[model samples]
Target: MDFSRTHFELFGLPTAYALDRDKLDAAYRELQNAVHPDRFAAQPESEQRVAMQWATQVNEAYQTLKHPVNRGVYLLRLQGIDTLDASNTKMSPAFLMQQMEWRESIEDARAGKSVTALDALSDELRAAHRRIEAQLAELIDAARDFAAASEAVRQLRFMDKLIAEVGDVYEELES
Candidate 1:
């Protein structure tokens, strides 16, 4: 109920990249049940307003902590780092080449209308995504290297976008 508390603190969780998802889910449900607006409908208007605010805060906290990418960015922000900075877009040249190759593969698959090829590409990208996520976990949790972790976050974001694009191609092929 303390508005100024960090999302992890609100959920009584450790402020680390590695988290117990089950714990988060349980805590979120408990908090939501406690402050859901409907539960305050019979209360005074002032109390209801407060409950609404609390509920909003709880939901935002839950959402931020639920996603691995968002949680990583939030952790960095807590340390006074902004991962979304335009200046932080510096990725390795090798990764740039890889991104181009991925785009080409996606385009080729789309052109061929090959569901099998697209599925293979999706699997490759997902494996890469998991590797990057593992790196993020180590960078943020063990090494405490926010700088490296931020870069991993950027790479993960790109992978997330690319994966979504592949999904779009699947839909287009289906249609």
Candidate 2:
């Protein structure tokens, strides 16, 4: 009910990368009902405007939290870590090497036209993603380890890009 509260506080969600979709949806509906501009139709123009702003904020928060990647980035931002910032693009060498290896393997698989190879890589990446998700939950929810979570977020971004590229390779083969 407090307009000044952040999205996590408003929805009573733990400040973590993993969220319960059901709870988020329920809280969003509740907030929409409370601050919907239509509910303030008889109020002054200023109050109605405020309601509109609150509604917009609530919607945006819901959108951001609903997606895993966006939620991770938002959690990083809350911790004052901007992963997308150019000047903040600092990652460990081992992580960078892993990214290079994945990209190379993807290229090799595509060039060989090996569907099995591509599928294997996809499965491997998905497994890695699962581990990353569990790590995010532990780091953010249990330990409050923003530093560790930020590292995982960086790696997850690479995995996400690699997975999308795999999809493109499959589409190319299909066509």
Candidate 3:
């Protein structure tokens, strides 16, 4: 229960992008059970405070490891790379064009109140997300190319926002 341990170490997981979700879930549950503050209800104030701190750390580490994007960012941070750096915002023109097309599609579908088109766009974005995730795994785990991985992470983050906007449009159309 060393606080200095990385999230992967805390979950007894490998320091890589590809992960076993079930293993992470199990480890999180086990750690939560061990450090749950309620178990220290009868302890001294100092012990209770320590339990609270451990619980918070365990929860934070579990969250960071649970999601693919957060996990990727954590991996990059561990290697001294900042994925959110402003200078890293530069993307290829082709990707920028693709992003614009997706935005236009969302706008058109929303304006038309076309649920079918929105669903199709959502499916396409999901496929793109999967492909990018595989790329992230390769760059981070197999290639060990943190620099390229950081760019891929930025792309993923953009995809996430686009996906969210699609969802927002769906909600608007629903109304």
Candidate 4:
């Protein structure tokens, strides 16, 4: 309920990447039940407003923590690591090269209007996302390597943006 608390603390959950989805969902439901404005209808306007705010906070926390990528990024941010910062954007050179190659392939496929090529790129991106998730789990749980996790978060964000762009290209081609 405290605004200053991290999302995990606010939700009364462990600050780890591998979360129990069912438990998180149940906790979210419970929080919504408690803070839902409809339940505070008999209270004063101030109380009702407070209830609404709490409900919004609960929903936002539930959303960010329930997802793997968002959870990892949140953890990194909580650890005082800003993945978006230029100085902290130090991904491995190999990864950078690989991303460039994938991006070029996506552009080429889209330019040629090759649905098969686009599908292949999408599959590769999906596989990479899975691998990144696994690495995120290990960095947070097994290794407790915040530094590595921060780097992974940056890479994942890049991958997400690139994937979305690729999807946009596919959509444009279809249209």
Who is ahead in TM-score, 2 or 4? 4
Ranking 1 against 4 by lDDT, winner: 1
Q: Residues 11-108, candidate 4: write the lDDT tens digits.
A: 77888898888889988898899999999999999999999999989989998997767898788888787766777668899999999999899889
> Against the true structure, whose TM-score is highest?
3
- How do the predictions measure up, each by TM-score? 0.97, 0.80, 0.97, 0.90
lDDT for residue 42 in candidate 1, whole number 0-100: 96
Q: How would you encode candidate 1's per-residue C-alpha lDDT over 81-175 as one tens digit per residue? A: 99999878988888889989999999999999999999999999999998998889899989999888988888988998999999999999999
Model 2 alpha-carbon miss at residue 34, Å: 4.9
Identify the candidate with maximal lDDT: 1
RMSD of each: 0.9, 2.7, 0.8, 1.7
Regions of candidate 1 where Cα sits further than 4 Å from its true position: none
Model 3 error, position 1 (Å)? 1.9
Pairs with steric clashes in candidate 4: none
Instruction: Give the higher-TM-score candidate: 1 or 2.
Output: 1
Question: Rank order by TM-score, top first?
Answer: 3, 1, 4, 2
lDDT of 2 by residue, 40-114 (tens): 999999999999999999999998888677788888888888867767666889878977888998899889988
Which 10 successive residues of model 2 have the least lDDT summed?
A: 83-92
Off by over 4 Å in 2: 33-48
Candidate number with the higher lDDT (2 or 3): 3
| Poorest 10 consecutive residues by lDDT, candidate 1 | 87-96
